[model samples]
Target: MSSRPAPPSPPRPISVAELDLDAPDGNVLSLRPAPGGPAVVAGDVYALVRLRGRPAATVIGTVAAGEDPAEVLGALARERLVAAGPRGDAERLAARSRPVSAGPPPRTSVVVATRERPEQLARALDSLLVQDHPDFEIVVVDNAPRTTGTRDLVTRKYADRVRYVREDTPGLAVAHNAGLAAADGPVLAFTDDDVIADPHWLTALTAPFTADPGLGCVTGLILPARLATPAQILLESHGGFAKGFAPRLYDPAEPPADEPLFPFTAGSFGSGANMAFRTEALRKAGGFDPATGTGTPAKGGDDLYAFVAVLSAGFRLRYTAEALVWHHHRDTWQDLRNQAYGYGAGLTAYLTATLVRSPRLLPALLTRLPRGLAYARAMTAQRGEPADGGVPGEHGTHHHPWPRSLSRLERRGMLYGPIGYAKARVTARRHGRNPR
Candidate 1:
């Protein structure tokens, strides 16, 4: 007997169009799809359009089954739902037309936490000195440095514009605490040595705090410095530091729905590279956890922990896409793999710490654990694959499978995170006793 014919292969996803809703001339968009190619479903395809370099809209279209993705996108453009043009044109237009704040910007204390990357530190310092916001100071903290090279460099090159401090502690949290202690401004902004702040970074970051005294934390957009390498592209495709272009306010009173982990999905809040805090609120929340960041066993989740702490303390957290910074990603595949592992380990450690510190949240954490695991697995499986129709902008056509070995390594790290965190706690206690 002849076997039934193999099931027909699934249709390949298509790259439809890029829309610019904030463009100067008008809303403009462009579509590129091969004729007679795969049919696209309207619900499955969408564009992540930006306004003034900030995530503004996630535009999804409704196309009939078996219809051309390009035609549907074009029709949407005509309806003025989205403008036709290249990806960043709208952002540029918004930048030019955007109005300045009426009053003087607040005094912001910019902190740069550095270890051994002196060259990168120099670039970061340079960016800070030229910020459009006038009333700000740069605080450079050299964390557990083997030598005084960073301090010396800062003294020689930026003595007039920057305040340099040295924290002998190795952990990122320790360095942050040191910076916080030294900062004089009411608003403290933190960026890594590997980041270059936009000229308006300070202005944008501090504005929300001035407008709302209740806001405790603010995170900005982090775009890639360059996407010329494979690793960089893959990292952004997997999920970059950018939260979106639109401004968002997260009030504890009005918690988001369907987030099983409420605030614990730390990565969603923002990256450590471009975040700011109200000095009073951060200090009251106890600053960063010494055991949770880089240079410690946890290897990452300090930023996440801080976000949760700020929210738990009854203060608002705002994500302002306009406060922009460019981050230099790890260019090598090995470094990227190591980063992935750190992320997994960090997340697990953060969860463990949450349970230990606040047992009341344990029930909520437990309720969310299974769903979290399922989401993690789903993300791993869909790492490089595009949706059935397509993803808008660069993500639509771009696909890169995360190496299986790397994915496994990250999973292994997640398994080890709790143990790592425990060890780190023990070490921290020992250090506390020794006073070294």
Candidate 2:
């Protein structure tokens, strides 16, 4: 017999406090400062409460049981109701939020997980060496590569700033965990070896922590170094987050998210491609999960999961659009397709896990599926059958043409997130193996 469906959950209490302020739409939003005492930021909008300061029961997303906490705080921040307090407090908060002192500053460590992409790895390491934020160490966790050139290049050229750790383990999380152990710093910053950081990447990434005592994790925006592929063009056109974004924070707390949320606004979610974490919080959550990322059958949701865990544990998670990096997009169609499938699978696993934790989610989950598929189809169809490209600006970008048809197709596929997870699970079971 088939298993019985889970019971529906009761409506959650309002997780926020009513504040006396109007929203962006001029609607009044009830706001409350997060419970367990606020971290006085002086001039900032939200208080930076630390993980240690909060009760064990209060996860990052938990509400205070009356109104939406994030909504209220955001409204206050926007209205500038949050006082910077005194001038001394503002400078202190600013000092804490800024990057470590520039010359021979605190020893910040960077962890990188690399596979066969030697060129990408090289560029990433080069960027680290050039950061305006000084006094940092580099740890390159070389996953089981087909060749040993990654080790050779690091040791020969970037030996002073780098240490090579070899993890025969194939998963990205495993490699990252290995790096975590190898490095020693108050803060741990991570960047994909395939990405290039801006000169201010480290400084900007570390800046927020100093501003808010409660800040535990920070993420930055990712721009495509090359948005030349039909895959990328399609992805970005659908608000691919390349234009800088943030997440909603107070949408009825259920799980801790890597991104923040607003009552009516959506921001960019945290990308593992560009993120940093306080060393202590990173360790408490047991690092990244190996079962749900690119190196596994699920293909890639570990970064967000880790961020959620941190927030759930009562640590503040942040996204800094200013701390930017340029990631190289896959040029080939097959690679792009695979990447899309992998992305879908990762999202599915994340949502599925959420459903298991909170069964009353049928309304939101089911409602979102078809909308996702419709988006994918429309994106791909923009590719317009066979074409050299499209009319100027039709494909996007100030330079080059884009295939509108395929762009729509990819967007539509994203909506079928649940379907992708199902397919991934089936493939894993049938093959009894995970793809590399």
Q: What C-alpha RMSD separates each model from the true structure?
A: 8.7, 17.2
What's the true lDDT of residue 188 in model 2? 90
Residue range 1-436, candidate 2, lDDT tens digits: 8998654332221121113323222333333332222321222121222111110001112324455555544443333322434555434433333333323324578888888777779888888788887667789988877898899888998876799999876666667777888888878998898787767788778766666656668887665454445555444434343423332222223444532221111123467888888888888755765444567555666676667556655677766555767676676656766765566556556555344433555565566557544543553444332211111224433223344433443454445555644555455445442322
What C-alpha lDDT values do all the predictions have? Answer: 0.70, 0.55
lDDT of 1 by residue, 381-404 (tens): 445443212232232222344456
Candidate 1 structure lDDT:
0.70
The TM-scores, one per candidate, come to: 0.77, 0.59
Q: After superposition, how far is residue 224 of candidate 1 from its true place, in Å?
A: 0.6
Cand. 2 TM to true fold: 0.59
Alpha carbon deviation, residue 408, candidate 2 (Å)? 9.6
Question: Worst 10-residue stretch by lDDT in candidate 1?
Answer: 388-397
Model 1, residue 364: displacement in angstroms?
Answer: 2.3
Candidate 1 displacement at residue 205 in angstroms:
1.1
